[model samples]
Every structure is written in C-alpha cells, then in structure tokens.
Target: MPFLLNLLLATAAQAPADYTEPDHWLCYPGREDICTEDLSATVIEADGETSVVDFPTARDPEVDCFYVYPTVSGDPSPMSDLEADETEEGVTRTQFAPFRTVCRTFAPVYRQVSIQGLRQLFAGSNKGINPAMAYGDVAAAFAYYLENENDGRPFVLVGHSQGTNILTSLIAREIDGKPVQERMLSAMLIGFNVAVDESGDRGSFKNLAPCKDERETGCVISYVSFKSDAPPPQDARFGRPAEEGTEVLCTNPGDLGGSGPAALDAILPAAAYGTSGRPPAPWVKGQEIKTPFVKVPGLISGSCMKEDGASFLLISVDADPDDPRTDDIGGEVQVAGTILRSWGLHLHDVGLAQGDLIGLVESQAAAYRAKD
Candidate 1:
C-alpha cells in the first residue's frame, strides 16, 4: 500500500506559520518544486492502441489557479503548521500539477486537520481536529496571493474534499459578495457536498451561482462522484444535502448544461488511484505505456443523478470484455475487503475529469480575455 492510502488526516502545532515564507507555498510562478514535474500523458484508445500527449507548462499563462488540496496529511496533531511533506507534494502531483497546461498554478501549505483527527471525526468523536486553524492558514495564503501575486489577473479556485470544505467557507464569507468575486473564473469544488436551499437557490453563496455553461464566469462547479451502480445511501457521508428540504449541488463537468449520460474524458494516472495499490492492468494487452498519466477516453461516462433527495455525479464504467484493453478502474475507499460504497469514486473525482476540466478552464479563459 502507498503512503497516501495509509493516511486519513494531518495537522499542526507550535506558533502559527507565516504565509509570506516561500516554504509555505507548494507551487508559484518561478519556484522549482514538486509542481514543476513532467505532466505528459499516454492516451489509450479502446482498441488497445496508444499515444502520448504532452502538457507543457505555460511560460506566461493567462490565468492563475489557486488550489487547496484535500486532506492527505499524516500528522498526529490536532492542527498542522506550515511544514510541508511528501504527502502534500504527492497529492498536488496527482491533482493540482496537471493544470499547469492552462494556468500558472499557485498552491499553499496551510495548517490542516490531520488524518488522525479525521479518524476521530469519522468515529463521531471530535477529539482533536482544528478546521478553523486550517481555514485561517488558507485564508491568509489567499490574501497574501491577492496582495502580492495577483495583478488584477483572473484566477480559478480549485479544491477537493477537505480542501473543498475550506474553500466553501472562504467563498461564503470572503468572495461571494466581495469585489474580488469579479476576478474569478470559477470555483471547482470536488469530492464534497455543496448545499442549495429548499427554493433551489444558491444556499452556499448568496451572489455566485453554480456554473451551468462552459464559459460561465464567476460561478462554481461542484460535485461528489459516485459509481453509477452504487448510488449514495440515505446516510452517506457525501452527495446528500446537509439539511432537510435542501439539495446538494451536482454539476457534470464533462457535459455541463446538457442532459443524461455524457462521455467522461477521464485522464487518470497510469497507476491506480489509492485503491488497488498498483498500476492499472496494462491498458493494452501486450503494450506498455511509459507516460506518467493515462487518458481512457470512453471507458467511463457520467450523469447528474438526482433522486430520493440525493444528488451526485453518477459514474458508469463501460466495461467491454471483448476489448483488448483493461476495463476496470479503482478509486473506492476499502477497508480489508470491504468497499466503502458510500465514498463511491471519491478518490478519483478530480483525476477522472482532469481533461474535461482543463478544456472548460481554457474556454473560460478565452471568454474572459475576449471581454477584457
């Protein structure tokens, strides 16, 4: 098993960390770090043919991406300080680094609740998790970025799971009605539930709404992915509204503003995502792909599923036994042999739609530049 699969949380101690310190940032314009690694991918067609795709970092990207990663910290403390580790780098490599193709990536290392803390939270025992401290660090980092790096350039906000939770709080309080909202391309909140009120209005944010169209600016795109076969349960951890008569927002990134069953352009790591503990059974029967990433174009499809007061991105794997390529993918949170169906495909939410997301961002960037 990999280190990421072993960790459920992380956190900080000692004096509060300073955001102005270069060490606190995971990636910025000129810094050479984990985010600067190669992001090239190999495209595996359904017929067992393969090709490589290069994702060159932009010398001068038009927009910036302010990313906050999901909880992968292995710290034992209640709250984590500004010390970054391989865990942070590893998650960013799989999630945030891919966006270098369209924008200058800006990632921050904030004090977050530790994986140990999450164990307690999941166990219904809030012993030592400090979410406020985590949010404070991220909030300060965003402020510092705005004051120091943002030169009136448009930017995108990206987060997953715990990061999404933190970003939701930030958006509700700071960005929703503020002047800075205008400069945002969109907020991609994955692997978490974003609530909307009984009236079907934006309960999460008063001013900013969910992104309905591809080029829609200053909006949000949020969803918790679930396997189509295993829909979220009544007491599922995600994909269900927080309050009665309310609904959790679900927007399919692959086919925004359209109806059922959109082909998912899933760009995942050549290796499996946290579950199976190995690389995918060679995409082609006898061929090997050397690229760090893999694009299985039509192996997956998704739709916005809303029924029984639960809303989520219903992912369906189009498994064809006769095809020479592998048909199975991995993302579930399993314990021993038990698959946590409620978690669904939470682990691969961002990775599965990485290509479609980049496309959407590019479209929004072009649209934003056209108006400017």
Candidate 2:
C-alpha cells in the first residue's frame, strides 16, 4: 500500500473493521441483504398506459459486480462511519440493487466524504475532507474482494461520482495491464469525467480501452449525463475535456459504440426524482405508483455529443405533447433554492440508463464465459 493509504487506515476511527465481516458489506452472496430485495417496476408507456414488470428469476451467473457507491453519506463528520444509513441504503436500491439481475452484487460500505464535507469543499474550505480516507477504504475493500470472493470469476467494477474517482485511481494502481485486468469484464465509471489522451483515448490507463460494443470485454463504459437543452456551462466541473488537449470520455449506455440517438431503457425510482423527496408526480392523470420502481418506455433517449471542449451524454426527454405521460424527469442537484446546472443530472448517471446497463452487463458476462 502507498504510505498515505497505510497511514489513513492506521489512523481511522471505526470506519472499517474487517472485510470478512458481514456488516461492512451492503450486498454479499447468500446474504439476505439490500441486493436481494424485490425489484418490481411499474412500466409506463408513451401513451399513458401502465403495467408491472417484475424481475426475472434469480440465477447463478459466471460473473460478479463489485460496486462502490457515490457520496450519499449523511454523517455529520468529515468522513462517514461504516454503518449504512437510510440515504446510503436508498441509493443502493436505486443504483446497485438492479445489477443483481446479471451478476452477484458486492457493495462495500466505506468511509466516504459526507454531505457536510461536500458542502465545506464547495464553500472553499476542505477542512475535514480527506480524500485519502475514502480512497483507503475503497482500495482496501477491493483488495479483500479480489483475494477472498472473486475466486477467478470475471467481475465488473461499477462506481459513480466519488466512487468513480477512487476507482480510477485503484484501476491505475492495481488492475491496469495487470493479470487482474483479465478478470475484469468491464467498468461502468459514471457520474464523473474520465479523460482520454491523444494516444488513442488511453490517457486514463495504458491497456484498457473504452467499450465499442457489448461484445467487447476488459473495456470501460463511462459518461456524465446532461439534459439536451441544458448542456454543462463553461464553468461546470464535469463534461469538460482535459486541460492538456485530452478528450473527456462519453459512452452512451443505450448505444455503446453506435452514435445516433438511442432509446434509454430507464428504470428510475418511483418515489421522487428530485432532492425534495416528495411522492412521484402523476404518471398519467390519477394512476398511483404502487411499485418502488418505474419504467418509462421511450420516455428518455441519450446520445453522445461534443461541443466546445465538452463531451457528455446528451439526455433528451422524448415526451409527446399529445401523449398523456409526463414530459420530464427530475435529476438536477439543488443547493439553497438554486439548481446546480453545472452538476447536470449527476444524481441519475446510472438511473438514466440502468436497464440498458444491466442488459449490457449480461451480454458481456456471456462473452466472458465464452472466452473462458
């Protein structure tokens, strides 16, 4: 381990005990945990019709998904404790739970920067925000998984926002071009920017390339989501190309390699799309959302777009005026009564194309099994 990581781990207070301990894990094999919850969705069509789509029967897969969630910690301290709270549990249901359909889920609770820490960072004072604290926990958890649980099975690494940032470093440090890379089927690094250099879009890592199609293994699938009408502002943090002439990677989940607009099989939460946490707006006129999840067919479409040094997933709501379905989805990050457009749909990076991602993972797992 790096000296700083070692120091952080040695200095941490109750952030982690042992990876073998079940409490440290949100989702593990053969455990009655969050990943094993019911994932039934209420499907709503373009013409205001509704139906229920239940998840397929559980089956053993040849691959696994080792996921690290974004920063959803509600701890008051700079670094969150290991205990999983409501926000963490809720986000896991939305982001990581659905992937259980394709691969076994393994989500580790880490000592991440809390909402308070993020607020401080945004306020120009990273007082207690320790990036090492988060990175150390994630790196340690990954090492434990590879040594204990992986067992030579092909695995997919999934992360978003803070998790993505830490995983980017982890890949470069541990997996890139290493023997472990062979076991890596693909990586879904969402809600963050990944820069690719002029050396054939390989700046982030030497050997790992972006996914061209579902058949490609040992590749990357990454993008930041932005509404088509509201692209990232010039001062936005995400979707901007690297300063040294490298492009920010943007891979459409619906159409990984293919270009034009592709329909997003969005399976978003039925509760609330925004920060207010209110009940979901009416899907049609008076229909109630009884299910925890909602699937809107042809309601959202995404495409890769590049303009003025910004490359991002352009999300377009294809709601027809004549159709009784709702015309929009809420994903913007709000702060102090103002919408943070620069963040752009940061909250829904996985949600926007969650269904498509699961399908892609299934295909990639099949390919990996074939190759093996």
Candidate 3:
C-alpha cells in the first residue's frame, strides 16, 4: 500500500495544468531574464474599411508584409507568445488572426502568423528538446503560412535565424519548383542558407540578388554578412554565390527600374527599426578587421556580386553561424542534422547604405499596387 501510494502521488504531481497562471507561477528561477519583454511590437488590423497610410507618398492603403521570427527558447513550448488571447470558450493563438493587422501595411489583405510554437512541433511534445524535429516544425509553419495567409495573394515572407530555415523550406517546397510563382512578391530568408542541401549552390533560383527591374516578377533578397574570408558554401547560408549556372539578377537598389539612389533613398528610411551600429558587445578576442575583402579564418562572406550596375554592398560581421552552444533545445537532434557537427563560424551581413529595408517593404508593395 505504501508503494502504491507513492506512485499515485507521483502521478498527481505530473498532472497537466488546466490553466496557465503566470502571476503566481514561477516560470524561471528568480533573477533570470525571460527575454520576452524585449520584443518591440505593435498590433493593427485593417479590414479594407480603415484608412491606412499609402506607400511612396508614404500613405498607401493597400500594403501587406509578414514577419516571422525564429525559436528563442533553447527548447520548444506551446506557441503562447505569438497569439495569446482569451475567449469565454478558451485561450487560443487564433492561428490566422494576425492577418488583419498584417494586411494593413502591404495589401488590402495582409496576414502574419507566428509559427514560434512550431519549435515544439519540431522538438516533440517534450517542449522541443529535439533539434531536427524543431527544424521540421519550422518548415511546417512556413507551409501553413503560405497555404492559409491572404488566400494566395502576392505577399512577402521574412525570417531570421531558425526562421530563415523555415523560409528556405517554403521557397523550395512552394515557390522554387512549384506553380505558386505568380503569387509571390518576394522572400527575405536572412541569417540562414537557402540551398538544396549543404553541398548545393548558394541559392535555389536563378536571380541571386534582390530583383529591382521593372519587369521582374518575384525575387529573393538574401545575404549573410562576414568581416572576413567566407566559409565553405555548404557551411553558411547567405554570402555565397548562386549556383554556377545561375546569375544574380539585380535591379540596383540605387537605381530601381528607371530611378536612381535619390528616389530609392526617399523611400527607404520610414520602415527603419533598430540601430545599424554593431552590437554593444565586442567580438571575441582577435575577431576585429583592419581591411576590406580579407577573409576571416573559417568565416565565409562571398556573395553574387554584380559587375554591371551599382552592385549591392554586403557588410559582414564575424560570428558562429549555427552555434551549437546556443542550441539549448534539441541538442541531440541538431547533431543528427549535421547542423551541430559543423563549425559554427558564419558571416553576418546586412545591406548597408542602400535603403531602409522597412521602407523597401513599402516600396515593393507600392510596385505591385495596380497588379492586385
């Protein structure tokens, strides 16, 4: 009877919570930062009846963009952060509710979804302690977003870090080899590689750079910055050249279609967020650079540089691309995907002095105004 009583007591201790009580709950040890409070966000919903600022004039009513984030937790948990709401019925992410807010910026019909919960899907029910599974979950969220958001209207997809991996899968599964080509405005899969496999060319499609030509349909703008020698193509994501046969098709951001940098610059700054300056913390000892184009040991910074028009400038910072140390969740699974086994050396870069990316989002949406 004593043994049975202990087993029953243990079972009771492990029971699922019928509700989440954050106020009284001790989610983490005292004094540890949750990091959730750091995200800057604003929510707006436009059902086409509202008056939203149009583009170019900086006041277009019909523009929509979707920004997806990656796994912050070393492990996975229910996607409570992305879309947490309370109804008399129950708490829900609402899955597709953010579209009303997302559509306000780009198109009359914009949508944004948070697939952050997918980390759990990938890592498994045990709160995404599995790496490979987390990756799969990321991919699934991309697919889900593509299929459900705005009913296949022209939209742009943006992601960072693990979010970039999900973007790559979306490009491969939906855009690259499929018929959804017409519906895509563009995809920005930053901070990760977009290749068929680790050994494949740097890009999956023909146009390596961001397309700026007036005649262009859909294009991808991707890059990883490096302050030194670029890593092997398979090792890092953005900086390498497109597949050998493929050329980086670009419309100089400085000269979009029939305009020059002045016209582009006028439109680039409004969407600006975050400082362009390097992080406050210095790179690990000996990582500073004294010259341009000097490749850092184990770091990769190659790009599909153009020779004709104003080539885009890529500024890379030295860092471990896929730091295994940061993989608090799914450490073993990451090991299986070869992500953990490889050197974490990666080049981080951003399009510098070109245009405000947030503004670029507005401009791109403007370019497609009449088409919709």
- Give the number of the best model, judged by TM-score: 2
- Global CA lDDT computed for model 3: 0.34
Query: Which sequence of candidate numbers ranks them by TM-score, best first?
Result: 2, 1, 3
Candidate achieving the largest lDDT = 2
Candidate 3 Cα deviation (angstroms), residue 114: 17
How many steric clashes does model 2 contain? 0
lDDT per residue (tens digit) for residues 1-372 in model 2: 022233344444444447877899898888788898888999987777888987653588778998889878878897788899888888888898988878888999888888787777667765666777677788888889888888999999999888888788789889998999999989999988877874436868889999989888999999999898899899776888655778888889899888899999998888664363323357666788889888988889999988777889999998688877776577777765577888888887898999998998888978887885
lDDT of each candidate versus the true structure: 0.81, 0.82, 0.34
In the range 300-337, model 1's lDDT, one tens digit per residue, is 88898887878889988888887777866767777665
Query: What are the candidates' C-alpha RMSDs?
Result: 4.3, 3.4, 16.1
Worst 10 residues of 3 by lDDT: 88-97
Worst 10 residues of 2 by lDDT: 1-10
Q: Tell me each candidate's TM-score.
A: 0.92, 0.93, 0.42
Ranking by lDDT: 2, 1, 3
Worst 10 residues of 1 by lDDT: 1-10
Better of 2 and 3 by lDDT: 2
Clashes of each: 10, 0, 37
lDDT of 3 by residue, 204-299 (tens): 554333555533447765543332232323433233334444432322333344322222221111121122122222212323322111111222
